[model samples]
Target: MTLRSTGRWFWASDAEGDRGGPSGRRGGALAMMVVFAAVMGCAGAFAAYRALTGDVDAYLASHRQITAQVLSLGDRTSAAARRAGTSAEVAWVDGSGIGHTGMTRLRGDQVEKARVRIWVDADARPAAPPMGGSGVVLGSLITGLVAGAAGWSVALLARSGRRAWTARRAMAGWDREWRAHADADS
Candidate 1:
């Protein structure tokens, strides 16, 4: 058997057979296309990450962190609450000196009148904190890597499928040729 390089793959053939055929060439082209697709996918992921980072930065800038006093703990003894955390009624004043009361989650160890740092919007309403720098970078990198791996897996599956189809066709042709030879000899 002889093996010939087709881009990143090796196409094998018998000693009497020529180096692959149309199917081999098509497979080589497909491989190149898959590589290109993976590259494009990674680039697109990075672009999406940059846009998301900007939006998160804007959110962080618009929000503020303030210390709030826990007035009371609600459902602190519940099994679900204990597993998740205790829900507490907290009060804080925004930059405008307007007082606000809201519900927030705190560790079970927290007690009434305990001071905790919380994020709030301009209206002193409870808000979620934006993604930190390290988290954003790590998340983006993982997403990009997953996308690239998925593309590569699909390419491999397609190549294997094509190879199986080609083999079936070749076998059919060989059977037909053998039958014709047998008939001619009779």
Candidate 2:
């Protein structure tokens, strides 16, 4: 096994004079990469936060909760409430005196005819449960993190694209110079 390996991922700079990065200059590229990563990360976090807040607010505002009963025996292994919880059918009455039936995810053991609180929409249909305080916080945090990662990816792509463009331009410049001095050299 020919050992020809260099730590490139952790250290991707200062390999000039023959085998180096694009553009023949890493100073500006490094600065731009840092700036792009930071800016995009911040922007993504902010944007995700704003969107999460708006969606959460709207969902909570449009939904309400009331007492409901388990109508059918939901499968225990249905994966609906497999995490220390059980799934079952439910029944509820909306504000307009209309009755509705739907499946609900209930915590703990919930047999048939068990009563539980469930979220309902305007048409008395089973809706997504209200986002709890902790859920909101956690969701926002995750969203921000994902967005930050996406932003960083975009920044890296942009930097790589710019570097490639610069390298191509440098190559073209060399080609042009060679063609211009062909006759003179001969």
Top candidate, metric lDDT:
1
Per-residue CA lDDT of model 1 for 80-139, tens digit only, reads 998878878999877678889998778749889999988888667887667888877887
| Model 2 stretches astray by more than 4 angstroms | 1-28, 75-85, 96-100, 132-182
Off by over 4 Å in 1: 1-41, 157-186
Mark the 10 consecutive residues where model 2 has the least summed lDDT.
Answer: 1-10
Total clashing residue pairs per candidate? 0, 1
Roughly what TM-score does model 2 have, to 2 decimal places? 0.62
Model 2 gets an lDDT of 0.67
Computed on alpha carbons, the lDDT of every model, listed in order, comes to 0.73, 0.67
Query: What is candidate 2's CA lDDT for residue 19?
Result: 41
Q: What value of lDDT does candidate 1 attain over all alpha carbons?
A: 0.73
RMSD of 1: 6.8
